[model samples]
Target: MTETAVEQFTEHQRKRGKRVSVVSPLDAPFFETERGSLILGDCLQTLKSLPANSVDLFVTSPPYDGQPKYGNGEKYERDWYRDFFMAVSAEILRTLKPHGSFVLNYRSKRRGAERGVLQYEMIFWLREQGFLFCEDFIWGKPSPPPGKFNRFLKDAVEYCFQFSKTNDWQFFPENCLSPARWDAKDRERRKKLAHNYVRANAPSGQGRKRVQAGPDMVRPSTLLHLEPEFSPNPVKHPARFPVELPSFFIKLLTQPGQLVVDPFGGTGTTGLAAERLDRRWLLVEIDPTYASIVPTRFENGR
Candidate 1:
């Protein structure tokens, strides 16, 4: 947009009592590439401009309920978090397509070296918002964060809470299938058997392997074993997640050319994944510096 157009747009928003600073990206700094857009601004406010039921998938990790770990995150207690998510999620529910999926990756914060009920309280709040508790998965961190407190060991896992508008949301399980588990020695025995199975392991512990044929196939478990990524120039963002992490869900939950959104854009991991998977993405990052890093990532992500 032209400078004059931006000025006109800014003036128009001011007449409606909306703060232009929070919406500056609507004019100039809002950028778009072939596969995605990188908007530098508050996530909740940006959702208002998007059309309803436009997004096919939302794969993001919020501010850990306003924890102090991230630079912009504020330390808030359970009650505050419950209400905060209630507000932000209403926008998510609105923009999400009828069969879209909202994948929230979040973990509870520790308080004074002790555990709290923040995670539970927040889950209850999400459920109350009329979002279906579709399925809960674990993001298993192979390398956990160092323990600084006395109460617990190193933090190794976090929840990937899947929320759907309804139970009939899109899910392509075949996209995330894992290699079938088969012992090298057992392969020869399998060639002679049809629908091989160790029926002796049943509850009765007496059933034989006499069933029909079964294929050598398997799929990923609810537990996703992915680790954090290391960038030579991580810039100001230290907790950058790997691109494969988002790619997994993008492939499973969305099809090519569909819209995918990441409210907490971070290092543009989700956006890059969307690009590789032939999907379009809309990403928002509150920190301008982090948001600035997104475009370059699409060009030379390494």
Candidate 2:
């Protein structure tokens, strides 16, 4: 879009009014819970209209290049994917607050006969554009669906690339610690400790893991294992990230009431996670048919 086009779109959005979405102010049912609202329309247009630095966290699994569309039946050919990604990612960067982060879920392509390395080029692209490279996690699917017998097990993992707009970003570790327990080895080791030393620290007969503070402090793993749920929508999108994907990231990245945006909000999984987390959300869906169903699914969840 040109300079004039962007300016015009921004102006139009400022005055788009409550009617642009199905947000019903007077409807008690809609406001019964504090969950954020969902909008229907093209994500590119919706994202462009958003105020700069308005979002706290951006997390999404944009449709894979040349892959099947979710909610919408269109197919994206591989040739057009790179240019497509660059455009969308740039807009996402623009919408994010300086202290915010973007968690992108993507799969590496199996383009040729030889096995390829995990794709990190996109990570470099994001970093060069001023987003800080935080960490890269591998989301491992313990029970992945089978693929053709001719090759190795179908790629059972997806990359979860985390980027921060600023050096200091939000991360809470106390929220994710496992309870300390007394294993057999710990119990045996305790028997040999000096009497006074054991007496003071072993009251509960459990050895607690020392809590540490810093960047290396218990950051969540990139490899996530989540069970896929059945979707009522007859036509399923080929690759869909689990709701746990967004829920986990949201918990670690933002606080309640912070806004989360997903430029590629397919089936509103990100919004669903945001709602459960008590966070505000703004979603963009280009395919009207898919856009319409998102709110319906939320309003009448199965």
Candidate 3:
């Protein structure tokens, strides 16, 4: 919780648990914002040292075995993929605050007519680890046409699986809604266009300025509409989420000054999102090359 703990860095390889040389200052991201600090290293060892139940939230997507390589030059063979997920999930459970939430983002691939087992397995394991299940939201990426697969159009969406350690969790609906609201005429028109559909009228305001109101059209069961930005990467990690993605969760589950940790901090998108939202953050990346690039990423922010 103090700067001293984070200032002291230690490296431990699996073979020899002995501590190595101190991390050079060049490895740090310029702490431009007071909201958070970013650390670069193997997540498992780094997380072990943190105070248990100290982190306010855990928001990250771990590397899946069969997914495209993340450009780390290391291939995770599928044979032992389940074991890998378990190991990492256990570490995540440990650091989560008693009432904190841990949200995971993952894409499920189709093998023939069936979907991958990762989603189902993850939900089960995560619950067993004491996390209460919250509904899953689909992150529909509407652009960048799907690949030419045989039967389907293949509009792939990322899943945001939300979980919390305790029933008393934080989620601010105000943070996730669009700024603009529909007016009475707009709602009436939309409702008339589709019978049986209901649209809440926008709130009225005083003076010349229209006070934007009327509960946002109830969020559709599924989320669509996104513009593609190149995945954030100094080392060019393959899979990355939009900064808006983290903004959604941060606004929903945490308050300003609460800590956010991303175990797989590729290109530091999560850190960037946290920076903008005024939340503290800790990022762990195994690749040295990617670690070195974290600071340069701050030049551009959400």
Candidate 4:
């Protein structure tokens, strides 16, 4: 039998003193670290190989419909796009744990005068498929591309839709809190106000003389104001999202040692975030060219 490309790649990495393995029966992992595996294959096929109720979180920004740049010079028709993602979503629903979350980062493109409604349609479809609609986070890009449109404003925000298989899904909002901006004077004023409110509302002799101010860290809002990678050409992947995007979700929805999977891994950004956050990850990318560069990104501390 011929050695697969991934097998050869694994051998090469092993020669470099890196601890790597190709343990999957379907295919050897293109690259493996202590905490993650980058697989080179179709995501749907790879996802099918996994057991049901195994994934802890599914986070990915799949290729947009009708985007030729990501696809190989051929535009994906709306019907084809819907069919493809629906198939993938079915697998995601099957594999995702009952207490897990799936965060989909997607944006629709405008055509001549009309904006696409596929993104919204997918949300409805997902809900119908029994996945609970948890919340939606707006990824506000601080530096969006400049464009002059006749009918619309500049596109600066993308949607990160969160879904869960059951109502009892795991979420740890405290882990992703934003720093509070209250000074000592502000804290003192709030504390005094809180004390007065308590005193007025309490029973005749039950009121306390003082009350502490709120926590130093507050819950983050739904709107995430994060800048994309500064460099025009940060990586070989054409549509790579900022690492902070996945990092935020990982911190919010998972603990230290859970499993996170990105079926449409582009340049393995999700895998990098998972590794940094001490979670196990699996990244599946169909494009070999894109999958090949993932190891380099990991090696260079990207």
Candidate 5:
């Protein structure tokens, strides 16, 4: 027998032996810890209850267009991309503060030699939702999934689209600085030319300053090289991103005590990253069992 959504919520609370404050009951706050809260429900529905402009940063990777089945993850038709993510974008834009940033990761799908357009379509749609197209980063995975066909070149990259509510948002480039890899000869050349000033063409009404060999600092680039070794024994999640992935964005876009959100917290990777960085988090997962995995994964390393 199928229980109603309200009935199921009440039953879940009773089974868990905890009292939850209820208003409409569609959205249920499943658990809370020192670092953050976890909600067990559909993100689209649960996100509706959050206050407007309350979140500081959002680091998430929604299920891509042609992903395999996972717990409680739906399989939308090919034509469902635009409307589905548009609704989600509107909600995310609402919860995001004027100075908030959203970093989204989407993978490119291939059907034989054909390429998918969901990732590009999402960028345009999110922009229409008033999110400024901040930047497009590539996660260059030297080691991609095994078992590739000969029809297409081995896929080795995924897209991370960074967006903001307005043109301005919180960002700390210093937080995720990449290690410098300058060659010895280049370093020596720069040192020899330190006293020399390199001039550039000045634009109209703009004065150009001479380029100097400033501090040998390295800023993170649009291409992120995050490649982790795969283990035969992984967690139950079918599509769990590495903790470092979200951690990079969390440190780059947010600060301590600021609120972070993951509308698609598969195995709570984002939440764990936020917790480690002293940022408050809100994770919304649709599957009860998967949502149940978050606390255990966070409190004790998995």
Candidate 6:
């Protein structure tokens, strides 16, 4: 008997001290690697096949309702879009581990002279479905497209809404700390303020007390500054987020070898980030064209 590619990959991972547990629920994956699998299917249906409490983290940027540039020629209405994702969210709730996290990268589309409230509506709907609303992180695009508008400034940010199955979700703030922004002079000032506070609170008879400067690295804020990155391939997906976007959440919410899933796996950006971080991933992409690029991405070491 010969070992299949997936079996070989699984065994290889196990020998390297990684727990290989993510498996394709479908008959076979469109593409498979040592650290991930890409399944070509409608995510709504495929996600339902995954066993309950299987996925550790879900990171994805779903297609906006009327955006047909994603190779889908049809434009979906707002109500249909909401219903579609609500069904998807129900499955996510079922598939996610009790302590797992779901990070949705989304932005509402603008209609005529006013901005749509779809993003907020989705948030409210998700909470109603029993997903605990965690925190909303903003992805600030430093290099927004150059344009002038009559009634609005350039759209410079998108929302990354974090949700969890339970309050006891796994989160490692230390893993996602950023370097302290203050310089030497600022540090000295902060130290002086801390010392003054300690001295003022202590009695006159007490010995003089010292306060240490703050940590060199501080916890990251909800706002993240990440410039969008283009795909190295000439034929690129219409919408692809920077790898840093998913990498941050993967580091904060998951451990090595845990399973991470991206339902709307456009060009496999989430899988790429997960693989590099030593986490297993399962990606479901409906478009075959976008799905074809994923294996090449991994093969070319992008």
Whole-model Cα lDDT per candidate?
0.76, 0.66, 0.68, 0.84, 0.75, 0.84
Per-residue lDDT of candidate 5, residues 57-159 (tens digit): 9888877666656644576545556776677778999999988999998875776668877788788888877889999989888777777578776667888
Sort every candidate by TM-score, greatest first. Answer: 6, 4, 5, 1, 3, 2
Backbone atom clashes (below 3 Å) for every candidate: 2, 5, 3, 0, 0, 0
Per-residue lDDT of 195-253 in model 1, one digit per residue for the tens? Answer: 66555666866776654334577778988998867565444674567788789889889
Q: Which stretches of candidate 2 lie over 4 Å from their true place?
A: 1-34, 69-81, 115-118, 179-182, 185-220, 300-302
Q: Give the per-residue lDDT of model 2 (tens digit) for 59-172.
A: 988776545545345555443445676677778888888878899888756656754333466677767777788988788877776678466666677788899888877886
Model 4 misplaced stretches (Cα beyond 4 Å): 1-25, 183-213, 232-235
lDDT of 3 by residue, 1-302 (tens): 12332332222221235334445334553233466666655677777777878888888877765665765455554444456666776777787888688888876567687667767777887788777898687887768544787776765677888888778877776666664457777756655454444445546633232333445444433363565556544456666678888877888889888999888886678989998888999887766555545555664453
Cα lDDT tens digits, model 4, 1-302, are 12444555566677688786655535577777999998877889999999999999999998887788864675766776578888999999999999999999988889779988888998999998889999999999989878898779988989999999999999899999889878888877776674444443456656566655557899999999988765434335657798999999999999999999999997888999999899999999876656666776677777
Question: Root-mean-square deviation of each candidate, in angstroms?
Answer: 7.8, 9.1, 8.8, 4.2, 6.2, 6.6
Residue ranges of candidate 1 with Cα displaced over 4 Å: 1-23, 76-80, 184-216
RMSD after Cα superposition, model 2 = 9.1
Give Cα distance to truth, residue 4, candidate 5, Å: 19
User: For candidate 3, what is the TM-score?
Assistant: 0.75
Cand. 5 Cα-lDDT: 0.75
Please give the distance, in angstroms, between residue 100's alpha carbon in candidate 2 and its true position after superposition: 0.8
Which is superior by lDDT, 1 or 2? 1
CA displacement after TM-score superposition, residue 88 of candidate 1 (Å):
1.5
Cα displacement (angstroms), candidate 2, residue 235, comes to 3.5
Which pairs clash (backbone N, Cα, C closer than 3 Å) in model 6? none
Ranked candidates (lDDT, high to low): 4, 6, 1, 5, 3, 2
Question: Any idea what lDDT model 2 has?
Answer: 0.66
